[model samples]
Target chain A: MWDEKETDRKLCIICSKGTLDMAYPGLVLANAALMEGIDVTIFFTFWGLDMITKREMSNLKFTPIGNPHKMNFGNRTIGIPNAVAGFPGMTNMATSMIKKEMDKLEFPEIPEFLEMITDAGGKLYACRLSTDMFQLHEEDLYEGVEGIVGATDFMELSEDAQIIFI
Target chain B: MTSREIAGKTIEFDEDGFLANPQDWDKDVAQELAHEVGIDELTASHWQVIEFSRSDFDERGEAPTLRRLKVAAGVPTKDLYELFPKKPAKKIAYVSGLGKPHGCI
Candidate 1:
């Protein structure tokens, strides 16, 4: 029902975590918004920058340690008792299980989904502060990344957009 | 019991104008339905989306979500968004002569 480009709705997503669980929430919502014709921009900062950095993209892991939600089986979950999270190899086991399930479902890997979203016109913004602090070069980021932008620039770009912190 | 005349055929529609029987839809009917929904013309690309949506409904027995369109129908998100704009699921359902979307209104 939108008639004008100037009036097009925009969604600005802030990804502050690099965990696989956190990454999907933002990417899925961003893709859904783009499918609905809403302009979308994802700003990655701190650990979130790990999601876009080429060297770290495939390494986004699921950490069961300290997570209140436990590993779920088909019907039930082995809710992590905080103490049990410290057991040797528990986090790695959980991560492997999640990856297996993702593979079974044929979900595109993190890098592929990021490319998909960008190909669909969703803009990916890397935080300049995070880049400088982490010593990340522009070449180290994914091909989809539009640029390294500061908080001020992001705010200006998102002035008319709904900001979603994920 | 509302009905619309499309391509010289009397087509039944629900009160909300969704096709009462989606099987009655054809490409010609789609062009007319598209216009009723404010889509002035149906390009080949538009037909791709509409056809994909209708075929998906036929196979799935429900309106296809925009997410499914991207994943299964192979319609790029940029194309889907540009073709249907805000709320592609509902708009595509309307133009494709399918029922209203069950999710996300």
Candidate 2:
């Protein structure tokens, strides 16, 4: 019986570590899995928790403060490490250019895509510790969020299922 | 309760906002969709976009590039933003079926 359960079990887990580029992959994967009729569960930890919370989700900004992928524009031709790429202002400029290019293509902003996942019956959860660390509350999360859960609780639900940390 | 053509049975939505549907998805995903959006049953506009996009992709043998889709859809650039603000354009085109999903384009 245990073996049978294990064979049929499948789970998708995403741990969003907060690189602007990294955030979307988790969401996209979760949504795609749900469409395939697979049982999916998302566990948000640390900076990843922000995406599920409402106040943070809508106002997310790429921090150029120390981001290493930032482009130094005029100096980009020289290809310096993004960590030393100009200053915060320059980082903002690069991020803006990226946003504009994305805009032209009709990519839905982060929050919109989250809504799509929710509408499609995907389940979302927030980590209690992460929310506490960030000083967030259950009410702060996006509309479709299931609830706050700890690691043990999450693992139990994901027992015998495939776990992916995105 | 009986099956009948209710006034609010279906909805018609376009760039401006929701219209002709009694169901209120406004608080959720529907609000996020700003470009000719439709749900719970297809509308004429939805059919047009789907049909035109499919045909366009079939003829070109490639997804209709963003510029071309905008012109064909008859909406401002901001409209697309409202429709799909998160995923990339290629994924949007595929999801929207503005291009055929299974390799048509």
Candidate 3:
């Protein structure tokens, strides 16, 4: 009597980059699903696992190294050869603006968000391979993290659930 | 591809940089919604809201309404008052595709 396609179960696999924006969607989606009366799980992998780690999670930064988003939109829009945007301060400006906007929304900081996930019924798992590569231990993750899991385990959970690679 | 198709559901740019299907929303969804509309390129601070919004949901289990967002996001309402100068937070959230818009989600 269970319809797989119509099932409300969802799974989110978050591969967080150092970019905080990149990291937030996965957590938000996962918690949202849970709140909606759907079952949810989250798998943190790659740079995303940094959120669970101690030394690097809070210190996450956006480096200028090879960042394609910083390219000038006008050049791309007009078919120019990699012409950078006229506004040199665009990046900094956008960053500051969003930060202010977020502050108004009363969004929690990273550490508190981790606690929110645990307090919610959602499950948090760190990627075993990514953890090993990063030399992270269980202590590096937030308290609610279930454990380190491999891709196979991740896929198995995602089989019927919606999988989001954040 | 069309705006109508994305009416109610939240559409976000995922870690992969594609138009992502957030599938669900929390407080972070609001900021992500803002990111979707305001700027094409998001800075670290922009992403910080995304993280915080999600975290807010992780703790609270639901997206904060307008008033809560004002407090949780940490920006003085006056600060945002100056930034948009014209648009209200609800409009900003709506344009950003934060909650169930009108049809999709």
Clashes of each: 0, 7, 26
Error of 2 at A82 (Å): 4.3
Clashing pairs in 1: none
Residues A110-135, candidate 3, lDDT per residue (tens digit)? Answer: 65666555554567888899889988
lDDT of 2 by residue, B47-95 (tens): 4454455567567655554334555666433443344333223333433
Which window of ten consecutive residues has the lowest lDDT sum in model 2 chain B? B16-25
Winning model by lDDT: 1
Best by TM-score: 1
List DockQ for all candidates: 0.33, 0.03, 0.04
Query: Tens-digit lDDT track for model 1 on B1-105?
Result: 677578998988876657888888888888877766567888888888888888888887988766567778788766776776655676788788888777431
Error of 3 at A127 (Å): 0.7
lDDT of 3 by residue, B1-105 (tens): 322123355455433232334344444544444444444454464444445544554576543443354455764433433332223332333433333311101
Across A1-166, the per-residue lDDT of candidate 2 in tens digits comes to 0000112445657666765556767876765554344567788889888777776675455545555443544555323355655665755655566566556655556776666556544578888888888888888887778899887888787887888887
Interface RMSD of 2: 15.5
For model 3, state the Cα shift of residue A33 in Å. Answer: 1.4
Displacement of the residue A124 alpha carbon in candidate 1, Å: 1.4
Q: Is the docking of candidate 1 incorrect, acceptable, medium or high quality?
A: acceptable
Q: Give the C-alpha lDDT of model 2.
A: 0.54
Two-way TM-score contest, 2 vs 3, winner: 2
